[model samples]
Target: MISLQEENDLIDQILGGKQEAYARLVDNYKSYAYTIALKILNNRPEAEEAAQDGFIKAYQYLKSFNRKARFSTWLYRIIFNTAISYKRKNRVQMESIEHNDRGEESRESDLERSDKEVFIARAMEHLNEADRLAIQLYYIKEFSLDEVAEMMGQRVNTLKVRVHRARQRLADELTKILKEEALTL
Candidate 1:
């Protein structure tokens, strides 16, 4: 964990005209930020674009950051909103394009991973967006319920319920996917 004092120092440096200091902050949070965006958007390229846009927005708005909250919490809210907006914009763009108009350039690369990892990713897609993000923030990023609530602008109890239901839904989806896989095998 970065000490609060160190984070404050970095923020102070960024605010004091050392623009390069912001890169340190970006490096520190980029992985988690990308994961959050990917969970929301379910597309690698768009998620990357959204994460980058979120960092840009965060840098632009740094002067307004409230020190009372954790920087991660504040930054994640921006990422979540940016990814949601990206998803909506992409949805619209997709609707306007003829199916044949989508070129091969937009295709995702076939990166290899474990079957279980792939299954988990698919199961996450089965979840409602809120539940998916709740699971990701609580389990994947290991943020506290209160922290997640603060980031999502929701009550802690509501997030707790969302997480519980998300877990159950994930379990069900995993079961079904595994069975289907077995049949194919």
Candidate 2:
């Protein structure tokens, strides 16, 4: 925890508007801030955004920082909160793009989506690397079940179970979240 005296000193310097001091603050806190943001947003671009946003917010709220807590702890919470908001905003945008439009064109044209694979990276973070690889191979990369089995070094039946279980777990989690939200509303 930064002492009241230290915090006061930093705030005095910041309030005096030492741009270099502010940059030093950001540099000091950025790694942990970015990690917290990434855990929520899971997208590099969004993580970067949340980290940057958190820094700006920290600058704006510097005076409000509690001396009892570590400066990094307060900054971490802000970064986390910002990342959650960023994720929520992005989920809506992704859903919009995911919807099938009624006026679809040729199959080849249908294959060309405006939203890129970057969105999938965020969803993939919900799974472990193994589950993520299985999902990518089965869905995104278009590998056959046998190929997936070979890649995973598991029996075909085992691979099938893993895929099925992964899908079920994801659906169950989403359903639970939706139900909780519906109750809140």
Candidate 3:
């Protein structure tokens, strides 16, 4: 594997005149970029999109990247920031409306919701942004719980509780929806 310094040097070369050098850089860092995007966005198509955007940005801003950081590290930060911005901009920020106490169907039918988000993702949608992010970082993104806690800016125990509760809520909601669907048929 090429060292990050080597990669940065290569990028400098590419910007200098060896434009074909972009191919090598792309081959080297594309997957890493995509994974970071996926981790942030959770949608494969959106991940691909953010990855493409990051590559373009990297190319356009290659001159702006000082040699202070490792190439991959800087690239990772670019994709991470881009993915986060893209998600925030694209996401439908649901208001936390109170569960209607008197309107069972409203709440129950709402409970029937399932996002096209994967198994973990559908469950994740139930959580508010904080809980969803905590759960994704700790579980799906496979960050250590401690790492997740740090990233989420919360106590480790609090992150643990959030992950646990998020999972439970997802399970309960999925089961309820599945059972309802079965009865409807």
- Cα lDDT, all candidates: 0.85, 0.64, 0.70
The most accurate candidate by TM-score is: 1
Q: Rank the candidates by lDDT, best first.
A: 1, 3, 2
For this target, which candidate reaches the highest lDDT against the unseen true structure?
1
Candidate 3 accuracy as TM-score: 0.55
| Worst ten in a row by lDDT for model 1 | 102-111
Off by over 4 Å in 3: 92-185
Q: Kindly report which residue stretches of model 2 are placed more than 4 angstroms away from their true locations once superposed.
A: 1-8, 96-185
Predicted candidate 3 versus true structure: per-residue lDDT over 72-137, tens digit per residue: 556766776788888877765412222333255334545665433334444566778766666655
Writing each residue's lDDT as its tens digit, candidate 1 over 1-185 gives 56788899999999999999988899989998998888777668889999999999999999999999889889999998898889887886766552554444223221465778778877987988789888887875577889878778899999999999999999999999999999999
- 1-185 in candidate 2: lDDT tens per residue? 34546656776799787756677667766776676566555456778988999899988998787777656556665775677678778888856654553224223343664323323333444776556545544662334677556534568888787788777766665566556658989
Count of residue pairs whose backbone atoms collide, per candidate: 0, 0, 0
lDDT of 2: 0.64
